[model samples]
Target: MSQAAYIRDMMSDPASDLATGPSEVSSFYSNLNVLLTGGNGFLGRLLIERILRSCSGVNTLFLLLRAKKGKSSEDRFEELFDDVIFDRLKREKPGFAQKVRLIEGDVGQIGLGLAPEQRELLRATNVVIHGAATVRFDETLRTATNINVRGTKEMLRLAKEMPNLKAFVHISTAYSNCVREFIDEKFYPPPIDSDKLLNLVEILDDAPLQHLTPVLLGKYPNTYAFSKAVAEDVIRRNDHRLPVCVVRPSIVIATSKEPVAGWINNVYGATGIVVGAAVGLLRTLHCDPDMIADLIPADYVINNVIVAAWDLAEARNSNINNADSSKNPEIDEPPIYNVVSSCQKPITWGKFMQQIEDFGLQIPSMLCIWYYCFKLNKYEWVHKMYAIFLHLLPALIVDSVARIVGREPMLWKAYKKIHKFSAVISYFATQQWRFNNNGVLRLSAKLSPADQNQFELNMDKFSWSEYNYHFIRGLRVYIVKDPLHTGPKAVVRYARLRLAHYTLISVLCGIIFWLLWTLVRFMGI
Candidate 1:
């Protein structure tokens, strides 16, 4: 179907273009100004596309962007459309750029680095979506505090200044409170006071702060989780007179539907493991095979975000209209929605690995240098043994050959980076978290059938097997830059690689058996 036809089918009733009513979520956003941060990030880009394509009545979208790599925000904004992710949006609404207004600013800076005029313009904003944060797991404590903690505080401060503000959605990770095994739809006590920690980072130098990171992180696994937890506390401690709520989505992956199926941009978190394994680099991972792999697609998260903002606005309107009605104590607190899959549709790491093997082999990438095989080791020692033999030894041999051929030796360095990534992700992979998503489910239940069809969050009917197939195919096509047309050639290459791999393994086993037999003969057995 054409992009225009797809939008018509998804957004409105097939009978007419005027099927959208005032009660619909799209109507709720009609003529409302929206302020969005982190418009260039993975989820951020999808959110922008969804809002523009679905919520067509939005007046103006103010994007807060920072200059990076010597490129101005304007340059970045124009270049954003250059990405194929926007191809569908561009075709659906070629005039979408007219509704977007760029604001040059940085979230990490004071007052969100907004100019006086920019602040004045944002006063008309009705919706604020704060999605900016330093996502690096190993980010320095100071930097993480500045972006995740302090930046969130600044956003809340700015939201208070908007007289017409209806909803403020702060995007966070589900692992923010991984220190606890069970997480509910409410706030927990932060590791440290947001103010005190921010002050310490501000007062100390880089060297001393580096030394203090571990102590400051406390029970948290890394700065990303630690700082995000504090940022939640920042929201809870504030007098939230505005319609503000927090959304915590677990390990976001590719787009399962909308815009395009299996579309992904970056290789973060579990995506790295998928790409590495698909290309025949990653052979082993230190993880529990039975542990729940709580992964949600990007479209699901964005859909939840849009619906959550609408829900918040509706609740606020209800409370105002029925002042004499008794208030639910739950509404007084900032609502937290843990948008995760394990609570509803659970898939194990073993099943996840099997899916990768199934789909990755079917549509193998031409970039594959070896056979597709992986081991999920429950013990760290076993994982290390496999890594040394399967990862390090092969990398060393490859680099040595490259050096002899007068080419730049890079395989060893690449393996070193891969090892670092695996170590950072080991904490989450080895354990499971039980998330209570009653709030998320309740919110979905509130939507009408039409609205639910437009903004899907219910995972009971979701298909992981189908999603996994598209996910592996996406990694090969999008992330690995291998086109789908090359699948036939790739399959031929993969078969040869698989044969060579088993032959080498059989030869090694035979040699080891002969050695054992010779030792026994030497001992006069």
Candidate 2:
């Protein structure tokens, strides 16, 4: 069959025998008590909301939270409700707050550092979704590993004790093995043994460990990726009797389609590119415009997680009677779903950039760019040279001006920090990695049409133009949370600023070039 026919068949509603009935949703829900670590975070928040909305039969959602000074878990939960992210949930389910129970806990400590009551709640839960981890690209290894690797181990330990546990879904990154050119739905052990890295961090002080991070992570681009890879390894090694699923999503960006279009709450991933471009701070980025960006929406990832949990539970239950065989399936053979876009259909980075630019122009007359240029200057060596120059020159100049003017240089510091972050991420920007998603395809093949629509990440159905509009809105409202940028006033201000800056830079470069040419002529060349 042609790939199109195959996909259509795969997406077609399953036969009644294969379909999950209402009772299944109820069973998934009543048996569906969930322990969600980092439930307040961007992806976590979306996942929680999605489950609550779509899986209304869900009995309870135990949100693991750390107790803050002078504030109770109840207070934290209340604050979360106040945010607009939960507004839709409140409207849809008036009493939905009752289903959410915040368990006082911290993931970085043993047993999730839960209290006796919280521990009891966790033990009684049927599913555990581990989504808590540091996403900062330049985070310290000590900090990243603590929450990413150690926290995962602690969660697994907790899951192992749950008598009625069905599925343990660990949220990981598609870039977990980014050092490799081709990634498949398979476990690639961490560059360093997880235990060894944990032990080394424990022995070394923060300063020493920070210095050694480069050596420790080696070819891994950043602490986030390195630590997540280790965490996945830990999960694979410690699978002991629990059905687990590893979800590796690539560069999760704004929502392509969901509860709301272009719904993005975090500024970490490709949202940074949109924000930088919209504000004109990023005039030139050293990236292969033609390469696939491999971005999946946050909601799409959450949907996959839910479906994976259901499928894993059903599959495990089916194999329960066959568990005693000498040839039991590989313990490490737990499904590793590459929740990425490269396989379904590829979207080029250049097209994405163009869409954003077009979206930016549609804001208003005041926000329109007089003229803009995107010169495709590709050089084998100059990309790195430009990266270094762009990263440092702005900060150096800004800092120098600040000192001369007797003013604090906040922009320079922000620039320096972002530059460091870009240095780590630029490697991926400059190259593309192919992920073999045969597993994702196989998983999709088994899903009912209703389930497939609910859990879809088909890039072939993605509309970049519409996505870019939401992308810009999501960046402004959700990521930046800048009221000024949401309306026309901000658009006017941005346009004036862009024109001023462009003129200044153009004049300066023109004068410098003219002076150099005159000098060459004076030298009698």
RMSD of 1: 3.2
The parts of candidate 2 lying over 4 Å away from their true place are 1-27, 67-74, 321-332, 364-410, 482-502, 517-525
Clashing pairs in 2: 29-32
Compose the digit string of candidate 1's lDDT tens values, residues 1-525: 333333233332322323443337888888999999999999989889989988888999989999999999999998988877687677777899999999998889888898999999899999999999999998999889998999999999999999989999999989999999999988999999999998998899999999988998888989999999999998887775677899999999898876667778998989998888888899999999999999998888998889889889888778778875356554678788999999889999899989888877778878997897789999999999999878887787678889899999998998899999999878889999999999889988998776777777889989999888778866766789877778788889889999988986686567669999999999999
TM-score of each: 0.93, 0.86
Worst 10 residues of 2 by lDDT: 3-12
Model 1 residue-pair collision total? 0
Best by TM-score: 1
Q: How close is candidate 1 to the true structure, as a TM-score?
A: 0.93
**Top-scoring candidate (lDDT):** 1
Instruction: Write down the lDDT of every candidate, Cα atoms only.
Output: 0.86, 0.73
Alpha-carbon RMSD of each model: 3.2, 6.5
